[model samples]
Target chain A: MSASYSTHSQEKTQSSVFRTSVCKEALVMDDELVLRQAFASDPRKGCELLFRRYYTNLCNHAIRFVYSKEVAEDIVAELFANFWYSRVFDDISTSYRAYLYRAVRNRAYNYLAWQFKRTDSMDAIEDMPVDPTLKPDEVLQYSELHQKIEHAIQQLPAQCQRAFLLKRIEGKKYTEIAEEMQIGTKAVEALVSRALTRLRAELKNDWFLGLSGLVILSIL
Target chain B: MTPLPKDILFDFFDGKATPLQRKLIEDWLMIPANEELYYQYLDEWETRHMQFFPPLDEALTQYRQELNGERTRRVRALYDPPESPFRFQRWFWWSIAASIILLATGGGLIYQDQWRYSTYRTGFSETATHRLPDGSTVTLNANSVLQVPRFGFGEGRRLVRLTGEAVFKVAHLPDHQRFVVDMGRGVQIEVLGTEFVAYARNRGQHVFLHKGSIKLDLPQGKQLYMKPGNLFTVDADGHGKLTETAPAQSYLAWQDHWFYFDNTSLSEVVQQIDEVFGVQVVISESGLARRRIAGNFKATKADQLLQSLSELLNVKITRTNDHIELRTLTL
Candidate 1:
């Protein structure tokens, strides 16, 4: 374990570590160092650092499932509250960021299940397993793209947003959604269509780092 | 390579394509280049609709307020030593003696009658019972405390706040009056009429229903129902588990000045000792914390429990002025 840890530390250049910290230029260090400092002294600062970094991203991820801002905020806030009060923050096994994201996602699903009154069995949200082969920079870029995509969706017309969320998140069929929303089937289709067109136009010109033409072409 | 039409691909992505057009797009996506284009559009499709944007600043402020409230409540709970004047020592005799003297001097009576709400406390190696106005009864374990409101006894909700371990025998009321035990940390156990043991004091609470049933309202708006012989454990970390087990009557053995450890870890035993006897027991070796011991023993005194544990684990128990240290017996 010590050998692997040493190699891991060696892999992170001092410059990158310094670049990561915007405040505290002289004593800028890695997450592990920050964690150790937290374990030793006043842990609130370290906890706040982690909370600030991932709070927005986690809220965005959670809103995808629960679809309510207040509920999502309550979920994340309660998670951090428990994390602090229960001392799990001191004993995180995996990378702290991954742990926080997974926690938020699981709770969001649970909240959605409770809200939908499905107490017996929770329907699984089919999400693609994160591609482990992607580099750290690629992961960051993908996360940024994900947030940007969510923001763009939020900017769409209200009807388009509702249609897209019900179909995509709730996994509702267009016919079923049309019936529920009291609209015709073609309106649902056009709403989804308009939503897609707007999204495509919004992302078409935005330059994403390391997103080659071939990659975009292959995926489209 | 032939370029696939964008309109057909979009329909296929949304699962709205006709059978014939679906086949066409499927075939086109079979090509790696077309597949890549499919994912790009798929990403865009998934990204385009956002339902809500939480105000991060407001959420942060709320979180900070919750944290500060918790800290303040904890401090208030610990320091509000009502009848016990010399509570700083927290040692077995000095604190209990202080309480006894206060009780004799009518300090305990004054404290109880002063506030509309009543608080019940037990010193180390002591257990006390308080009967509520609704005919329900609560028995607190050693070093535990419970507060019952004087104003709203049997009116609507029979609510009691607990800071340590307690066993409750709730009276069944007509009209289905709610009997709720607020266990703090956003956890509440509501029972109409039941016999259950609630253990708080640690970061979380463990509730075992010996008879009847109870409903637990968790922090994240999830409700859990527990039946007889069910053990529900929830921690401050937002983790919860429900297990069906044998009647946990042994869990309340502490009420009788005894402890029953069934394959429990030494660390937990140490914590129980600290709670029940007001003595901090520190094991020098970290590995010894995991040593499991099962036994039924008396817990009237701190040294007696430590002595039994020393013989059981073959460790040397040393008691200082404030803390007890357990060390491996040196050969």
Candidate 2:
């Protein structure tokens, strides 16, 4: 098991990290240099640095899925401990941070999916994350934008619009869209392009980017 | 001659094309239906939720502490063997070794973790490719950030929170993956397996399906399955109206860095340039803003875009610092 951090820090490690600026920087860096040095070399400094590196980002990321600080913090601890004890990160080839992030995302999603089924009920937009920091105006804006977007989608041309939605919204491939639509790839591109053109015209090609940047955020 | 690979769709978007390669895509764009790709991307970019989401500061802080402590403990154990005396000198050596590691790893700063934070007051631009536990791939446009938890995904269903617009290309899983993209306005898109482009922004949002299928659960609780070539429209109330025959290519053109203003007015063009370049572009004479324009320009900096407009409109575009001033240039 390349998973290290094997030390027994599993004890309620408590959230007393100094919240040093260094950890913040490390958190910001891709998990490349850190993970590569996991076993091949010493990264930043030691296990503490690893904690400092990923602690907050992991916690924030995990909270979106888990809804419990205790669980979130524990996940961070385990991830760091594994990186240190086994240097499993050393085995990773892609962005170390990406790997860890992917891991966390998967864990969180699994928990959410399980929780969803246990409730025996599914609500569209269920448990909408109402961040306290989000002002009422922003919340309103998100809803307004959602409605506007729906109308915009309705305006797209028939074949082109269908192809665009199938590819972009459903997460399918062109071949899939083509096969489903029983048309060529060229047809799919047309659907997406035409749909977007109508939307651009509707918005008058105005401040959509600004609106989206603010409202569209990490749901993880 | 070898045919261009499938990447032309993306290569054109990123500006990595060679001259010959560019010529092909450009020529392809001229085709009536082909132009749809650009229009679609433009609409997609316009409405994506690319703006900032509230920073989760406090939660991030606590997680850091926990991870940091675990790391520190491991290092302590590695340096101070069980038999080694708990002497001051041994402890001091461990501290020094630890400090050395700290310096080598960049103090963990995520240098350029992403492109510049947000595009200037105009807006920041970013494109992200996400690999879901379900093995599917999703891409987010600039200014749009989709959040996913650290935990892994499970069977059948996959869920995600999307505050912004994104293009999804789902990789098929052994089990049919149930994919959901949640855009906050009570807009939830649920699909089994397919590909599509979703553009969501303030004032309006739209979706163009290129392949497979999708089920949209509107804010008002209406369930709509948008079939191939079937366009779906919904208002804030989730009341959906459908249409057929939408040319979908335009839905993705923005990815090409190509902005097409077909018979677009001057005011609208300038407004668009301002947002894209993150700089203020003011038409010196207010009347000129209403003038109509017909042509295509690079989806690039404000200056380049303005230059193209000036040339075609037979006008002069002057720049003072980042402020763009446009006026009719006597032919």
Candidate 3:
């Protein structure tokens, strides 16, 4: 599904460039200039334009790390709200898009850390083994984390891997996955739970410790 | 080194960049402007390969409501006086009528006593700073009243009656005169020269010493000496406890329009908003009222605080007239 979407996106990008037939960098610069001018003249209009321009992109970018649609949207919405209320645009030297993306990335990292701490405390209560040295913000490398997650998913048992992928990636319900696998819903839940535990164990030794745990927890 | 082309950066984003190209891009990202460019490109890439498109119209509508609420609050703050004019006028007429009746009934002593002491008051959502006759400064929090005797205020002893919260900075005199703040319920704070916060409300009485030392005279004839960071609190039933490790600065944050809460429950927070800002908040769900939050929030107006609370808790807060309701978002 993602492969076909990416192909279609490539075609759309090429067509957009051909239709404009101008330097994309110049267009981006012009947009920034206009946005700055709007902010200088009337901040409300600037806020509207800014929100419209980056809300979707910021949420999409944030979902890469947080792995939850609601959380990603919240992260972006909070960024926009704070930007407007705090008047951050007045002193911002960087483009609004850049500042927003960077801010959202940092917020997403912080959210992950908070989640890890909450689950870590719960794990302590349950006497589960937890890695203490793992710090998401310190060790977060986007591409590397993605590769590590993919690698860990591949190492799961075949049925467990299928159940996990169908649940986490495709966002299918337990009942749907059970029907697809010709199993009961309870069996599907057990398979997914086992997959999460094994993935956490598999990724713990590689310094991607609490983050992968949080990623799987977010699915739940 | 020459800047990496846009295609190479895109390839890096797509996890297809060579090791050397990735290394070069990482180095280039060290520059701040280059970092901005990096995000701009990332924004473009995500736009082209969009995974999810949020409901922009709904978000815009929410944003507009927040903005409108803030603007109306600012406008109201600028134009609205602390108390309604008609209420003040009605109170003035009733006092005049009562004073005439007292004179007619030959009850002049009580009226004379009212004239002997001057009172300082802060209306709802308002704080006031006043310099007393003794050159000491007192900053009264919202909805507080302090009474100082007009005649011979700082002669042999200094004493004042307080209701609600205030911070006092007592000026030292060469004559070694002591200042006493008489909070009702037999709780009095005595100090030679010190800075402390006294909170006397329907709930209880509390005194936090910021500098110097003070003596708290509690009920049952018990007395406690408070150091710079000591917090003496008495409940409504006059049960007193002293905390030595209280964060003194957070207690003073309210003077600067900031509220500091440490794992405070939502119900208690709502009660504080009622006291400090005079805003009525109703949490729809009983379970939600027990949720605890810890943070420092800055809000000069009621709506700003409400907005921050809603955002922090991911709750939906709606205001109708003077009443505010909080509920969990049903998404």
Highest TM-score: give the candidate number: 3
B183-239 per-residue lDDT for model 2 (tens digits): 767777788778877766553566778798888887667677888766665554545
Q: Tell me how far the alpha carbon of residue A14 in candidate 1 is from the true structure, in angstroms, after superposition.
A: 68
Kindly indicate the candidate among 1 and 3 with the higher DockQ.
Answer: 3
Off by over 4 Å in 2: A1-220, B1-128, B154-156, B230-243, B284-287
Clashes per candidate (backbone, < 3 Å): 17, 145, 0
Model 2 residue A41 lDDT score: 35
lDDT of 2 by residue, A72-170 (tens): 555555555556556554344333444455455444443333332222123322322213233323322332333455566666767766775665444
Best by lDDT: 3
Q: Please give, as one word, the docking class of candidate 1.
A: incorrect
Q: Supply DockQ values for each candidate.
A: 0.07, 0.03, 0.14
TM-score of each: 0.41, 0.39, 0.43
Kindly report which residue stretches of model 1 are placed more than 4 angstroms away from their true locations once superposed: A1-220, B1-116
TM-score of 3: 0.43
- RMSD of every prediction: 20.8, 27.7, 24.8
